[model samples]
Target: MSFEILFLVIYFVAMAGIGVWAMKRGKQDAEGFLLGGRSLGPGVTALRLQSSSMSGYMFIGAGSMGYTQGYFSMWYALGDLGGGILNLSVLGRRMRKLSQILGSITSIEYLEHRYPSKWIRLIAAPVALFCMFFYVLAQFIAGGRGLEMVSGVSFPVALAIAIGVIVLYTFLGGYLAVAYTDFVQAIIMVVGMVWILVATLMAVGGFTKGNEAVGEINPNLLTMWGADLGYQGQWGVILGALLVFSIGYMGWPHVVVSHMAMKKPSVARTAGVYSLIFNLLFIPGPYLVGMFALILLPNLANPETAIFEVADAVLPTFAVGIVMAAIMAAIMSTADALLLQAGTIASQDIYARFINRKMNDAQMVWVSRITVLALAIIGYAIAAFDPPAVAAVVIFSTTVLGSAFVPSYICAVWWKKANAVGAISSMIAGTLVSVLWQVSGAPDATGIDPMVTGILASTAAMIIGSLASQKSHPVPEHIGRALDETAKIGPIPKKMLIDQDALLASQAEMAGRHE
Candidate 1:
């Protein structure tokens, strides 16, 4: 067999083996399947979170942005350099402690407990699922495109193959499998990008020659402000792009869930440092490689394929396969996390909580598997319909999640008066504004990112709704105590620790006492 095919076969087999191993090793409960029993270590947690956060956007979508917008695209990298650090510092340890204290296996469940409102769970779960579906769809599209380019297969067949593998591993092993495989993928993605970047620079006679070549085509390609595309030069678009990668990292349930799953809350402290280093190494390579592609393959039609084309042209066959697999790794790492998140939301939040509250561990696992498969099929169908560019879909979905959840999430942690009314109103307003902004033509119409609109609207709603409902819906004393305890930088008292059953009983007892 050809080297590319051989390498891919090995990679796929290795991934499958990990899935089988995880299925055997991991716990069988819903918490285990969805969050790996909250036992992931620092390295694995950091890499997995980084891999999922970066996604195929770094390889394909970001590269395309570099090729199209030149140095302007570096704004994304600049914004993302410390995203993981910011995320962990702001919400990681506290969220982890709080999730366990409240018996929250999913982010939606956490929101429900934090706000003490069924309405919050009801609205938040659906909105999260909606945003995540689009995110997963984008990853599916990236997978299809990468496989079609490397394997010489039809997009549909490649898409099916991608979905099938992702579903199998995610269904069988769940988060543990996803996390371990993401560790491997994270290494591959970074190594491949760094290798490609160094080789491409060497081939083109270093930075000076590279810049000269690009300068010959159009100096505009090398500019900071970039080509004038109506709103491209505007501060809003630039700041929006920055915010989407920086602060927006906090709102992603898939990424945020990582904070809830680490072996210990202290893992976030170390993991944050590791993730920052990984991002620093991994983020810039794709953009630089894309810049190199401008000098090497100027006439290439689809700039998204710049990385793949460069790999094929510059590297040996075996190396090419490895790089291609890394590209696939980027896609799968994100796809698996998004798939798992969607499945967890559906099975845990929707199925067990709303559909049938009596689901046992075994039944929940099976339901989660089925839900993952179903979501994969739906995402595959959406991908097949020729969606927007990978970066666009990713950014749009990130913004939707950020606007809808970030305000509520921040308030849940810091604001004692953030009640169900404020949380629900913020979610509804953010989601509605983001959707309407997109439907109205996004930045082209307003020269500001849709995320900005959604965030502003959501923030306003939170303030107004909370004040208006303060008397009617005061913060629960138990939730307030839990929040204060989690906010402290130490272990929760053993006496205060409780499992799901005990948590429910305590809540019931508290209600009785209050009544």
Candidate 2:
């Protein structure tokens, strides 16, 4: 068999094996299926978070941007770092506590509790569905693209295979499967990226020659920061792009679900540290790889295809197949996570909470699986449109999530005075305003990013209206209890690790409550 086909078969078997293992645990019920019974360890959480966070965009979109933009792309990496710091320091602990308090199996569940409005939950369900649906589609498209690019196969056949693998693993194991697969995929992604990065250094003849070649192409590309050769770029534009992309980190359904899946909320502290370090290495990958391409493959027509160009240039055929599988790993890791989260939220928060409260765990799990299949199909259909541009789709999805949910999520953890009236109002206003801002051709609109405007406006509405309508919600007792629980951050020993018996006991309590 061809190396590409061989690699594909190996990857499929590995993913399926993970799914089978995870399904054993998933048989427990909704919590098992969605949050892995809140038993994910620090390493698993860190790997899953990083893999899901670095999506198709990082490999294809960010790579393409770096090819043209050079060191300016590093701003995106820095911005993501900044966002991670914010998530861990400001929102991370609180989110863990809150999810436990509200019995929130998903992010939208937390949203419904904070707002206490069925209407807000209703609005959020479809929005989450839409964003994740497109997000999954983008991943499938990238997966198919990777297959075609590596194997020289037709796009349709490649797409079908990509979608098939993702659905098989995801439908079988749910979040449990996604988490373990994410661990493996994260390692593969890092290795593949580092391999290409090393080859890029060699291809460009070293850092100094790389800089010289970039300068030869366009002096601006060699600088630490600047706009595009044409007027399409700016320092502000780059900063805005990076900020919008990364600030939404905590709000994306997949990423936030990682937070919810933590076995111990304190594990987040350790996971946060590891994630920060790993992201630093991975985020700069595209920028460096793309810059190398500028030096070696300047005439390459499609900048997004530059990573593959470099891979084919340096690696042997089998190695190229491995790299292709690794890229698909990145794509599937994110797609499965998002698909599971969306399906979970749809069944539990939307269908169970609003549409069908009497639905049993078995029924909910079935619905969640169906939702996953439906979303995968939708994403595949969208990817069939074959958008060559990566930045646009990525930016649009992040912008919507960031604008709509980020502010409310922040308030839920921080602002005690925040109420349902404020939460519901802000989500609608922020999402609508952001959508309108984009519709108004605001991506090119001067200095401010659309998110900046939408977030600011929605925040004002939430704060002012919350203050004005003090009687709208009495803060849940669980919120206070969870906060009190978190306030007692126990002293860390010289060697710290979770006590499994105590962890299992706590999980049993959560399960009992669910029952």
Candidate 3:
């Protein structure tokens, strides 16, 4: 076998080995399977969360945007750098404490506890699951494209192989396998991308020469504005890009779920610092490679393949295999997490909580695994038949999820007056406005990104709804007490705490009395 094939074989075997190891050693209970027993240390938590947040979009879509739009595309990275910090600072510690206090293993479950409304859980679960399915489909498309490019296999066969591997590991090992593999994959991604960037820069005679060469073709390629030199450089467009990734982190289920799984609230501080450093190193390299591709493969037909094309042209066969594996790592890391989130929502939130409240730990575990497999197949099928533009799919899914959850998520932890009515209205309004904006071509017409509209609308709805319903839908006293206790900085005191068991028992008592 060629060195590339050999490297891939080793890579695939290593991933499967991790899965088997996790299955044997990792926790098998529902909480352990889904949330890693809330025992993840700072380093693992940081790497896993950062890796899961970034998909192939960082390498493929971001690179392509750089190649097509030039320096203007860097705005996305600028936004993301601050976004990681914001997510950790604002939601990380608080959410971790609240989820544990409320005994919420999933984001939807967290919302249910925070709002204490069946309608909120029902609405949030399906919406999150649907958006996450599309996000997984985008990753499948990215994997298929990478596999096809590197192996010269047909797209369908490549897609099948990609999905098969992801499903096997994720199905068998669950969250533990996903987190550990993500830690490994995160290293590979940074090292590989940095390698490709350095080699390409050296080959093209460094940044100065590369820019000159690109300038010769079109000077606009080096400008803050894109080649269009018009609306693309507008402030609204840039602001939208910045806000989407930066503030949007709060709403992402797969990303924010990491907060709920950490070993301690303090882990958020350590993980935040580490994740910020990782983002700084990882986000810029691909976009730089995209710009470098301008000189290296100027005539390349598809800009999105800039990173792959550059790597294949410059790296040795064995090194090429490693780079390809890194790309696979990027794609699969996020895919596994997304699939896991979808499964957790379906089985834990929808099935166990709503449909069959009597499910034991073992039964829930099996249901979760089966749900993971089913969702993977569905995502794979969508990718196999007719995949939309990967960038468009990613942005849409991210925007929808961000719009639906950001306002409510932030308010649940911070705003004492935020009731179920406010949270539900914000979610519905955000989703609806975002979809309508996209369908109406408002972004194209007005040069404002849909995310901006969605976020603004959602925020407005939250404030307005909460104020309007203050008299009719008062915040529950227990919830207010829990929030007050959790808002403190230090570790929660055992004496002052209302543990999950007590809370559940009290809720049951209230239900019995009402009935």
TM-scores for all candidates: the values are 0.85, 0.84, 0.85
Write down the worst ten-residue block by lDDT for model 1. Answer: 496-505
Candidate 3: segments with Cα more than 4 A from true spot: 14-45, 90-103, 173-181, 255-268, 486-515
Model 2: per-residue lDDT, tens digit, 1-515? Answer: 57777887877677667666666554456665565525667777687668766788888887887887787777667877887777655355456555555566567776776567787788888887877776777777777777777767877788888898778757654433544556777778888888888878887887788878888878887665643543344555555666675676566864453333444556555777788878777788877887778777879877877898888888777777778777877887777778777878788878897778899999888998899888777666666656546666777777778877888888886777777778877877878887788779875666556777677777888887788888746666666554554344345353453222222323544565457
lDDT of each: 0.76, 0.72, 0.77
Over 4 Å off, model 2: 14-45, 173-181, 224-239, 254-268, 386-388, 471-515
Pairwise TM-score winner, candidates 2 and 3: 3
lDDT by residue (1-515, candidate 3, tens digit) is 56676788887777667666767676567765555525667777677667767798877888888888888878788988977777555365566556656777667878888998899988998888888887888887788877777777888898898888777656554433643456777778777888998999998999899888878878887887886676445787787777777776567875544333333455545666778888888898888898888888988877777898999988877788888888887787788777777777887788887889998888877787887777777777777877676777877888888899999988888899999999999999999998899989998899988889999999899999989999999899988976875576445464433222222323443454447
Candidate 1 global TM-score: 0.85
What residue pairs are clashing in model 2?
none
Q: Pick the candidate with the highest lDDT.
A: 3
Report the Cα RMSD per candidate.
5.7, 5.2, 5.9
RMSD score of candidate 2 (Å): 5.2
Q: Write the per-residue lDDT of candidate 1 for residues 10-125, one digit (tens) a residue.
A: 87777667666767676677765555524667777778667766688888888888888878888778877746666545365556556666777567877888888788878888
Query: Model 3 lDDT vs. the true structure?
Result: 0.77
Model 3 residue 397 distance off true place after TM-score fit, in angstroms: 1.0
